[model samples]
Target: MTPLLEIALLNIRPGQTEEFEAAFAQAQPLISGMKGYVRHELRRCLEDDHRYALLVWWETLEDHTVGFRGSAQYQEWRALLHHFYDPFPTVEHFVGVLP
Candidate 1:
């Protein structure tokens, strides 16, 4: 089966980019250690410093939706990172259609 890509568009609270990055550093290990996790990245938007994109690759959709979200680590992940958002991000999953 094709790998799943999870994307989250994050808009952090104004002036909290540095703190959020630091918190995310602490939170990274939580997601990285979960079952079915392949890899992930966090990128800041060029035009908007408060905006970010979080991309995570998993072996399967359930690996993220069920396995990770249901794990204890998710709670920690939320605690570390969730408050930074001005509004919660929208998360979506995708699969390669070509190449």
Candidate 2:
């Protein structure tokens, strides 16, 4: 099966970018340590400093939707980073269609 890509478009609260980054730094290990996690990256938007994109590769859809989200660690992850959003991000999953 093809690997799943999870993408989250994040819009941070004004003046909270630095704090959000720091919180995310602390939260990163929580997801990285989960089952079936392949890799992930968090990137800041060039046009908008308060915007970010989080991309994560998982071995399968369940690896994220079930494995990570169902784990107790998810709560910690939420606590660390959830408050930074002005509006919550929209998360979606994708599959690669080409090389």
Candidate 3:
């Protein structure tokens, strides 16, 4: 069973939306190529500043923990994106309870 992961990011600068989107677009291929990865949904709060969210579905936590973290793609992801973030991103994992 795939687990749903919800990630919220507090963007850094005000006018960085385009840059952030571009970075994520570049990183999408790396993220999607991981083992056990199912899908990803990205969102932005129009009323908020620099607040973005990602809802991801994975086959297991190990996919993210072992597959993603241990892969070179993560390093590339970080290299392409980690700096544009403001205070950094807060990521959380959740298990399915209902539905």
State which candidate has the highest TM-score: 1
Query: Could you tell me how far off, in angstroms, the CA of residue 99 lies in candidate 1 after the best superposition?
Result: 0.3
TM for every model, in the order presented, reads 0.97, 0.96, 0.88
Instruction: Return the TM-score for candidate 3, rounded to 2 decimals.
Output: 0.88
The residue-by-residue lDDT of candidate 1 on 1-96, one tens digit each, is 667899999999998999999999999999999899999999999999999999999999999999999999999999999999979999999999
Compared with the true structure, what per-residue lDDT tens digits does model 2 show for residues 1-99? 767899999999999999999999999999999998999999999999999999999998998998899989999999999999879889999998997
User: What overall lDDT, based on C-alpha atoms, would model 2 receive against the true structure?
Assistant: 0.93
Q: Model 3 lDDT vs. the true structure?
A: 0.81
List where candidate 3 sits over 4 angstroms from the true fold: none
Give residue 35's lDDT in candidate 3 (0 to 100). 93
TM-score, cand. 2 vs. native: 0.96
Between prediction 2 and prediction 3, the one with superior TM-score is 2
Q: Could you say which candidate leads in lDDT? A: 1
What is each predicted model's overall lDDT from 0 to 1? 0.94, 0.93, 0.81
